[model samples]
Target: MIQYFRFLIISLLFVSCTDETATAEFAKGADVSWLPQMEATGYEFKDEEGNKADVLQLLKDRGMNSVRLRVFVNPSSDPRSGHCSQEETVDLALRAKEMGMDVMINFHYSDSWADPGKQHKPEAWEDLSFKELKEKVYEHTFEVVSAVKAGGVTPKWVQVGNEIPGGMLWPEGSTDNWDQLGQLLNAGYEATKAVDDNIQVIIHVDEGDNNEKFVHFYDNASEQQVKYDIIGLSYYPYWVEKDYTETIDNLAFNLKDMVKRYDKDVMIVEVGGLYDQVENTKNLLEATIKAVRDVPDNRGLGVMYWEPQGEKSWSGYSLSAWQEDGTPSPALDAFKN
Candidate 1:
């Protein structure tokens, strides 16, 4: 009888430790949304040691505990640009899950890149009425999330829309039309909850250093009663400010203030630096990570490098952390510390 009691206590302690460890895992993520497409084009990824390796494994070895993938409603048929469809996202997400990495599903809501400058409504959703558009947002969000769940992996985070600093499903859901934007975002949020009540739903916006923009956006969201769990920001020094130090300082200040103002967790969902400037990139990443870690009450989750594997030859995207031999740049070392 004493032996049985001892075994029960030990088992309970083990379970409790496991739960705490899982909860304490900070998100170190990479947005490899183009990995599948890149691999299809015969691109191979190498580790820092210059040895060929599985991209997902390479990232995991680099201290990346999570991955973010974007999904489009209906993208171009071209294999290169069209692979982010619902099914494709599910497959990629499943792959990440199998590797013991948390997954963040970013819904673009459009067929192509949806950012602050252009929030193009999906081609199929262009003709829908305001009411119909709201319904479409909910349906599409629910369908994609459901498919992801059905694929044997439930994403740890679900971003309702990508880089909607101004708003999404534009003209109708633009920032100026706060009411409609809130309604659309709420629809997406509700759909996500319906699929997985525990999943953290994020609302992403570009310009992490701009406290004013965040304040304006969240204030409006509060007024409209838009429900969400995380505030995702895109902080690119090259685009936001010419001085890297200034950008870092501004971002750190805003991150702290944003959490206090809105009382919500925050994350740098997108960030990148010039691949050629390896040292600078490393410094930028280190500073960014430190700033995020300093957020009060651990509300600052972590930073995600956007498309660090994007080779210029294949994607024409200049911002990458890969060398000519396809190995990750040394700048990635910042993630270790």
Candidate 2:
């Protein structure tokens, strides 16, 4: 596989491609679905009378080709409290499919949010050793995928774990323990393949524009023999503490190199900017679109505005704003080419 920075220069040489040539290569996708917590806070897919809401139709209408839903095995709190169980997610997935949108399942492998800072295993698997954990991961993954399939919705992509920068499932398979992490990832990969070899498996990480982190994570995963089909990144200019343009440029360049080196398709599975700051939001969104559009050919699979219209907005984690009666923000229009 191609290592990012080492081959950066070579990628720079072929960066200039005509728009027609670029579009013919990499198509676009989105990760519009929020996690369980966000969903429960008031982002209802069903109306008070139990009818389908227009959000699904709106996404399809707005040109979003895909919706990425996160699945949590189980949670200490109520399952619906921002941590999606198999049932809720599948229901959502089926709806997305019905709306003619592709779906991607992101297995957080934890009961709550799993990112660079935290990864808390579900209570049920907290005691498992490496081997037991691997088997458990496979069993859990298979069950989730199976549930989605049985519900009459097939996912186009499945992420093995969500932002596994410091490892997943905790203790035994944490990032510091590469051997365990490799086994953990493989468990999910195996399940995905068993269910359907065609569903692309993604290994996701945060800090999309950070070349060093991207290089380190991918290289370590390669050394551990972790299998994945897509390079998934989470990019948010508002959250990232850096000059937005430089960060985006670094990310675009890194993505091109990652595709060239890893031989995998790239997806900005999770991305968003603030809508409250109207001017800044517009600028940030434009920069983001340009960065994604800049990637060579099929390598840049485009981005999803992560919960752009989430309830109450990004200021708080509530789902109130996405309700039908709620006014849509200018953020939605930012993605238009």
The candidate 1 region of ten consecutive residues with least summed lDDT is 74-83
Q: Estimate each model's TM-score.
A: 0.94, 0.82
lDDT of 2 by residue, 123-202 (tens): 88877776888898999899999999999987888999888888887778787899889988988999999999988899
Regions of model 1 farther than 4 Å from truth = 1-23
Query: Once model 1 is optimally superposed onto the true structure by TM-score, how far is the C-alpha of residue 26 displaced, in angstroms?
Result: 0.6
* Predicted candidate 1 versus true structure: per-residue lDDT over 190-225, tens digit per residue: 999999899999999888988888889999999999
43: Cα error in model 1, Å:
0.9
Whole-model alpha-carbon lDDT for candidate 1:
0.89
Query: RMSD of each candidate?
Result: 2.4, 9.3
Task: Give all candidates' CA lDDT scores.
Answer: 0.89, 0.73
